[model samples]
Target: MNVAGARENVGSLVVHQSGIQCFNCKEFEHFAKECRKPKRVKDSAYHKEKMLLCKQAEQGVPLQAEQYDWLADTDEDIDEHELEAHYSYMGKIQEVPTADTCTNSEPLE
Candidate 1:
């Protein structure tokens, strides 16, 4: 789709990184956008990245540490290792006694 813009969209440009692999051609050293090979049928799941890793293996590229959706990278993995901590914090907050909590009290001797 043609998006009207001043000159071009800067974020769309992917920088060249030797470790980056293309999902389209399953080739290393390029973005899928720069891939010259015909696109394979893209999948909604990570099946493509898995195949991409196979290519990475043949080319001696180390497996990617994590397969992150480029668009959602910022929001994803927010509680990856901290889910328990987050749940404990919420539980502690729920246990807190508010000002309205009734308490049994008598005049202290």
Candidate 2:
């Protein structure tokens, strides 16, 4: 209970949460650093440039179409779609052959 020495107790810092931390939500296994959601960095010009390039590509692509479709879908549905695509892409690495897991591989191939 000594207030004088409290600053010295670095080990007494309390951890309030654990588990995958969502970057967008900002809460533990997942940090904003590991977030799949697109994030803009305030101090980095390189990130701004990358974002501009991505924006340009989105303007040229069917990003609106996909976003509109996804907006109508549930969060779980969207996550399932993204996770499936992610896993399928990972499964296709040249160093390894995985069982045919993805139904839509044309665009990727």
Best-fitting candidate, scored by TM-score: 1
TM-score of each: 0.28, 0.20
Clash list (residue pairs), candidate 2: 19-28, 19-29, 20-29, 20-30, 21-30
Residue 85 in candidate 1, Cα distance off native in Å: 37
Give a tens-digit lDDT track for model 2, residues 1-109. 2444322233877433243344333443344445576653322343233344455566775443323332233344445654565455445434433457656645444
Report, for every candidate in turn, its global Cα lDDT versus the true structure.
0.49, 0.42
Best by lDDT: 1
lDDT of 1 by residue, 1-109 (tens): 2343223336987343656766556676666656688755533233334444455677887654334232223334565444455444444433445558747454322
TM-score of 2: 0.20
Kindly give the stretch of ten consecutive residues in candidate 2 with the minimal lDDT sum.
65-74
